[model samples]
Target: MEKLFELSHQNPALFVDILESIKDAIFISDHEGTTLWLNSASEAMCGVPKNKITGRNVRDLEKEGLFKPSVLRMALEEGKNVSTVQTVGEGRKYIATGHLVKNKEGKVIAAVAHLRDITDAVKNTSKLQEIEELLEKYSAQIRKLTSTKTNINGVENVKLGGKSNSRILAKKIIEKIAAVDTTALIVGETGTGKSLAAEKIHLLSKRRNGPFVQINCASLPESLLESELFGYEKGSFTGATSKGKTGLIKAAEAGTLFLDEIGEVPLHLQTKILHFLQSKTYMPIGAREPRNADVRIIAATNRDLEQMVEEGTFRSDLFYRLNILTVKIPSLRESRDDIEDLATYFLNMFNEKYNKNKRFSNEVLKKLIQYSWPGNIRELENLIERLVILSEDEFIEEKDLPQKMVEQHMSSNSPYISDRGTMTEILEEMEKKMIIDALEKENSTRKAAKFLGVSQSLLMRRIKKYNIQLVVEESKTFVK
Candidate 1:
């Protein structure tokens, strides 16, 4: 109240000391946007010394990456108060407010920008968003569980809980195909959960309340399969029951009939299966009339029916009919991110079954992930059950692993588990190492591509992406 402007002009050091004592950062700039002066708080917030920024223009400082978007410049250009959130260096955030200083004629001469650190607020906001997202995901899952039509249980839920993009896409595909009542084909490697997929589809479909009858075509002889699938009339053939038998198709009336290993069905029986798919009718042996059944068909196969069709084995027509709504489950090796989750699920399951408290050592689990699961999920499940039953120690260790896995671990150069960085980063490192090994052994890009089972263009792109340095000698490439 003692005329602050006159006091500042009389003793500038007093004003400077007063501004320096303030907690918030204060930056002063002339109307032309050149840095005039700033307090110690501004120097600390900007992570730069006062001398480095004192005489520089705001535009030059912005170009030098001091702080994004000069707030003083904003106040000078807009001729009004301005506020903005700005980022400095790597992770700090600040809320900047700019105000203009005017002369007696109301002409702007200087601009003062105040900055308040809001890095904590921004981090808390990001954390809150993540929590909300997690809540929403759980809410969606709860909704699916409460709805009977969409209720997926047992191994179905476990299979769908994969963190990989492929598994997430398969879950979406299952949900979509379940809504529509139609024939669905499940295709995957022998142990990749094709049967679980089919069962999940049946439970999620409109036929949840009805019986789900399953038959493995590969397990039955042609003569027996034909009789068991279509049923037999009374006194139909030798050894036939006096009373007619109900076939799987008829037993699953108003429900779903899961044909496991449909690709193994005989060519003669393929036509009959195609007929059932087309007309929803089949004839019982020794019956004069065709029997009608209200049942949905869900077929699964590890065999490539299309290739079989080309070889004159599986019927093309039947393959076409079942291929309309297909669900392809990725093998455990192809979806490595899901391996840990699946292994843990199987461990818990076998533990519960055997009434034992057992867990895998960290190294053992890493070896499981590193091993190429040719038998897919089935092999992993069996291995867990075996360990749960046979292992003398409570914790399954690396020594307890199979010989092949231990050999592979010894021969492999890549890390089985990530000590730091994300899964993606760990995978990239593995890929880089493999590429380098291939280049060293093959000594040529084309040969290396063949060894890696990838196209030359793809290998080149990956090499470029990883920034791998290669030394070429007489058309041979070497990783430097």
Candidate 2:
């Protein structure tokens, strides 16, 4: 040790050359925490030159909560080495190690520390976590496909039928997952058969015979969601069932758990979910032992999760995990070619459900093709159900459809309206039509504004401009 110190003093340039060769930042500080020496790497790490770091107290570099005094205390007083993962310089992560340096008398003289950048390692870890989540999702989907009983009650088996686009997309997804296990995130507007795509993935996976559980994250509160997903012991909390319930995760053991509307899951819960996706295990509420989960996870959401991540609502790590094998379901408006087939399928489905043999009139078919269905297949299904139940004649005509749908047809067919009108006029007409349509569809301007893509003030202005009559509540009216 004496010989080394002599060499360092006599050949300070050589000593600095050795230290600078290391990729990690290396520094020496006196017992009082004053910086004595630092290598070139320190300049790169701290964004300051070695000359600036020397003759300065380490504490003066105070970077918020990073580089706690406790670390230096441990190296100096305890005479021990310490290591921790810390964020440096605007949140860049580093693995820092500190060690004490002793004099000839065995008394601590100074402390030395090194910091290695681990940003890439952190990023790779995040990607691995995502891949694991995708695997779990696929596993859950396999179980759902293999099981005969559907998870959703009262939802009859929907035959896999759609336009060429839907079929082609579905086939592509199935083919991709044929060999590997990866969690899949299905994204689309509401009612675009995202759930159906999830089911198909399960059916094609190796875990086909396992259970497939589905939950809507947006439909439940955070407190209740924890119990619903991870399950709770009996008397875990108020309103708890007597029989301790197994969480959907455990229930889906060796199967698949589908989390729909995953974007709505609370922020705190996201951390726990990230842990589960990484470890494939979780502790049940009020349970001490960690329960092993062999389930795959498939998550679906209609919201923009990446945007949510940027807004700090969704965890970036969790988002990456669920996004490994993303399948975007096209909106109904985007896939107009599929409308005729989907409409016909729904007509047949309702025909069987209602025990009625009704067909679409030529006028009704043309209107259906021309109309842009904002609600996708679910909307189409409801419309078909209404037609089958209300239409007395064997054929469904334009008059038998909803008032808003009929108005859309009229607006499209109107000679007074031009597609290429001035922006102001076009917006005005659109506002008027949307407000009227929303009121007709939902029966209130407040609710209409929510769907009309405009503010209530604007809707009211258009309503006045078009001289639209507001319908107050009339005598009790019922229409079959």
Candidate 3:
């Protein structure tokens, strides 16, 4: 038994070193289901250093919540190779293949497995739905293992507003995924709550107790952003302070670091960020040694990174790294059903904030739903805040809305055909009403048809279709 398990390290074929050099995680366990070895890649992807669990039993690792439905255990039980997609390392997706290792006498001596991290590969939007379903299914096992956060009705501190299907669906997805440490890429138009979504994911995570550091890539020049994200050493530059500064990555240790406007990041910095994503290690500027930070990354971008990659503006590698889990927050116009709910929520929020008792009039609510919010949620919230502060009356009425918004509402929801009917029926109804009104004025068919700009015969046909009487008793409809 000792001789069979010794080949990995004592055979001198350098199999252990070979596995360590490969990027995919590799694990080996003896026939008794005891862990024999785990390579460096396995240690990193599994989020457990080799020193912590070397020579430990596989059951202990499972009990410690290292990974779920162990492929190695399954392989040992079935006495054959097993393949599966498992959730590991705080909810990361991996493609795992476990094989039964045999001795020279054809006896099963150990179990070996290779795990490829597929967190980012499966995140392409075209494959996103299928991947999400897969993650959700496997994540159930993981959730049982790491149910550390206080959950409310199977959700966490996700505060996404609005009751539209799109909004609600988006919030539900975010809550389900918030417990994991996977990198999330939020794609939406500017001011569409991309940052808010990122924050919610962090707040709902196990790292909620840690800081939520955010840095906008577009807000600073390339030179300054590098220092801000990766930190700089003392005397690294002319204006360097006596005390060295910590990077956002370092500052957000064991927490969440949100990179907002990630599409605006320069090419060189993208490479560094990609390196950090891969290894969780970074070298500060002018530093002699690299340091590792245990931080979860959530990046938001409005630009089309794939298009930019085609145009050679954004690096493809970095784009993939950031898009491990993509959440596309829809524009406000796309989620019309949520308008009223969002409006009411904001109304109550602003009322409490400004110590006001203002309310939104029925007309105001109608107008709000009608207007197309090109600027998304941010624009809506800003307008509500302004209305609450500026309105003299207790209610924000139609007049309180901006001119453009009011005109848009009027244009969209005009009173034409307010009742339901086919196009031809509506035209006939209008024709009948016009003919009746004109006839009451002139009391003659020729003058009525003339005022209607139609032949008398056509007006007569429409009148028959609408069943409107020609009586002039009170200038109103009296069917005959």
Candidate 4:
């Protein structure tokens, strides 16, 4: 130790180099709290050179906005170790740990502080909060559309309104699971009403009076996900909110906590979740003690948990715990028999909403049913609402359907040869057909350009390029 000290004294530049090599900023001050030296990291963090900061009192530097509530000053004043969150400039945050260096006589000789940059973690947490708020806003809108209301029995009824046998069986399974208070898993493809089913289960459960908090596990990064789920205490880490946060698990206290896309949870966090499931307790980020929560968990996922377990991406024990009461929701294609009813329901709902008397023509409805709805119920509802608001005619014709749907319905009669054509030829034919249809419907190049989402000059050029024949009458253009 004496030799090491002698070496440091002999090669002071080497010691300085070692201190400068550290990523964390290091600030050194005399017992009077006057800056003695600062490393390169400190200069970058404070946006000030060492020559300017040296010999300047910490109080003056604090006032000058280099850093607020100086840790070195606190350490000097208290004659002990001090730790605090320091703000440098407008959004950058740092954790500064300061300690007094004492001589052999117990006299404080200097104060040193180590600062770690924490801006990214703070920004990520803020972003996660914003995303959660936005998700809540959309969920509220969905609730309004689904008409979440209290019935005569005082139970919130979320109408999974469908007549298909598969849907009915899924609903029945959900109801049966809701009767018993246990962990549940809802399995289905995306847009197949997994979230809605989770809500229905929560409403039917004994904890209906409590809150139902739902979070999409896949929407956040792993760094933010753990804190969001279990929460963190105030003053626990740099840039944490002053009042801290109540995690989603705690928010659902006596009710259901629906974890959407549970398969996306990181492998490391799976252990924590499993522990919580087993003991009804979890430890928040930076927390010293475990906290208990009485919330029932309902996890939903499009990915097969069993397959994930086999592949080692998901924990088998956690999967087994969550799969206690499983409810599988069928996709819209699997329940095509209920498409007409579901479509009509959405149509009437949207018609009332828009104060329109729009009705789907039999042909349009037939076309809708014929198309394979890859996006499931959600897509169907969105299409119906769009038709209600956008269709000028009272009866929504087959032509009002989206171009992709129209093309799919008429693929058998399509002009482009699928097997014997180059990509360019097929695309050109498709473009020509779209231009002809738009010209016929709009009767004007300007209006057709708007419909086709192309500039007027570009549309004109395309017309000339394709050698499209146009019959002009007065100011209107007709497809020849």
User: In order, what lDDT does every prediction score?
Assistant: 0.81, 0.74, 0.77, 0.83
Clashing pairs in 1: none
Per-residue C-alpha lDDT of model 4 across residues 138-177, encoded as one tens digit per residue? 5445334332222233344577878899999999999998
Model 3: colliding residue pairs: none
Tens-digit lDDT track of model 2 for 150-232: 44432235355666676568658755853457777899887788888777777667766777777877656686678768977
The C-alpha stretches of model 1 lying farther than 4 A from their native spots are 1-161, 238-242, 411-480
RMSD, every candidate, angstroms:
28.1, 16.3, 27.5, 10.9
- Candidate 1, residues 1-480, lDDT tens digits: the string is 679878887898978899999999999988888899999999998888999999888878878888888888777878899999877666589999999999999988988989999999888877766764564464344323321222234334534546788987888898888899999999998678887788788878888878777777876678667767787787564323245566778878888888888988999999999999999999986789999999999899988899999999999999999999998999888899999998888888889989999999999989999988766877788878888998889999988876667756654664555454678886776688678766755678986787688999999999999998999987678777
Q: Alpha carbon lDDT of residue 141, candidate 4?
A: 53
Candidate 1 at 295: error in angstroms? 0.5
Between candidates 3 and 4, which one is better according to TM-score? Answer: 4
lDDT by residue (tens digit), candidate 3, 266-344? 8998999999999999999888899999998889888889999999999998888777788889888999888888888
Cα error, residue 26 of model 2, in Å, equals 68
Tell me how candidate 1 scores on lDDT. Answer: 0.81
Q: Please tell me which predicted candidate would have the highest TM-score against the true structure.
A: 4
TM-score against native, each model: 0.53, 0.57, 0.53, 0.61
Clashes of 4: 0
